[model samples]
Target: MPTVSMLDHLVLTVADLQATIRFYEDILGMRAVSFEPADGSTRWALSFGAQKINLHPADGPFDPKAALPAPGSADLCFLSDRDLDEWRQHLQAHEIRIEEGPVRRTGATGPILSLYLRDPDGNLIEVSNALHS
Candidate 1:
């Protein structure tokens, strides 16, 4: 059986496109991009490193979409370049509430230190860094 090698991107159905963009871009530091898809609808995405999260409108007519895409449904973990302490401070500076954690969790490769917060649409977002042995 042939399996996919790695993640390139994922789609997020958002309640408010601008709010989602603001939370990811302003608070999380992901870059927001708007593109014309040739169908006249301006599409949006949040990009960081080599990965991106494409934003789909809550009431989308987008082609080849998920069966039941909804806002506040995803629980995502993001690898932060900043240390956990720094990420905590940055989130505090933005006045975003820390719902849970600074807890140690298993990452894809090894241990990670993570902090949790909620996006505007209530998606559970985790920002973490590798815990060095």
Candidate 2:
């Protein structure tokens, strides 16, 4: 049996593609790498270093409140540890909400600081840096 190695990407359907792209780019610092146009609409891809996040416009009328992910549920975590204070300032400057302990030490591994936040789509994302091996 082949074992699962790692996540490839995440696809989120949003009401506004541009707004979502902006959130990822401006707030998360991901780069808007590419987009595909089909039938007058488009699908876009954003990159955080090597990770890819794909965005597609919602197909029809939908309720955002009903579609949001449950609290405490996360779709992904983008690990980083470089200059966490700067990251916090960046989020605060943009009025983006953040969870507690962007500064906690990991119990399972060496010291690491983590910051958690949600995307426009309510997907949980984490940034952390490993302090040791």
Candidate 3:
């Protein structure tokens, strides 16, 4: 069987694409990039590091979509270079509540110190710092 090595991107079905874009871009510091598809339709994506999250309107038609593409259903973990303390301060300054953590968790890369929060659509977002040097 063929194996895939990395995740290129993931799609998020949002009630308000613009609002989702704003939150990801402004709070997470991800860049929003626009593209014109072959059909001359425009789409937006949030770019960060080597990966991106594609945004789709919740009511819009999308092929190969999830059976239930609700906005708050996803639980995603993001790797952050900032230390746990800095993450706490930054989140507080932005008025975003930390739901849980700065606790130890096993990440894809091993041990991580994580902080959890919810996005505008209530998706559980975990930002973590690798505990290993």
Please, what are the lDDT tens digits per residue for candidate 2 over residues 73-116?
A: 34565666467888888889999888756666563456777888
Runs in model 1 deviating more than 4 A are 38-40
lDDT of 2 at 60: 48
Provide the TM-score for each candidate, comma-separated.
0.93, 0.70, 0.94
Candidate 3 per-residue lDDT, tens place, 19-131, comes to 88888887788999998767788888999999999888888936668888887788999998888888889889989999999889999979998999999999999999989
Q: List the residue pairs that clash in candidate 2.
A: 80-128, 80-129, 81-129, 102-114
Error of 2 at 36 (Å): 3.9
lDDT of 1 by residue, 98-122 (tens): 9888999999999998899999989
In model 1, what are the clashing residue pairs, if there are any? Answer: none
Where does model 3 exceed 4 Å of error? none
Compare candidates 2 and 3 on lDDT and give the better one: 3
Error of 2 at 105 (Å): 6.5
Question: Which stretch of 10 consecutive residues in model 3 shows the poorest summed lDDT?
Answer: 61-70
lDDT of each: 0.89, 0.69, 0.88
Per-residue error at 42 for model 3, in Å?
0.3
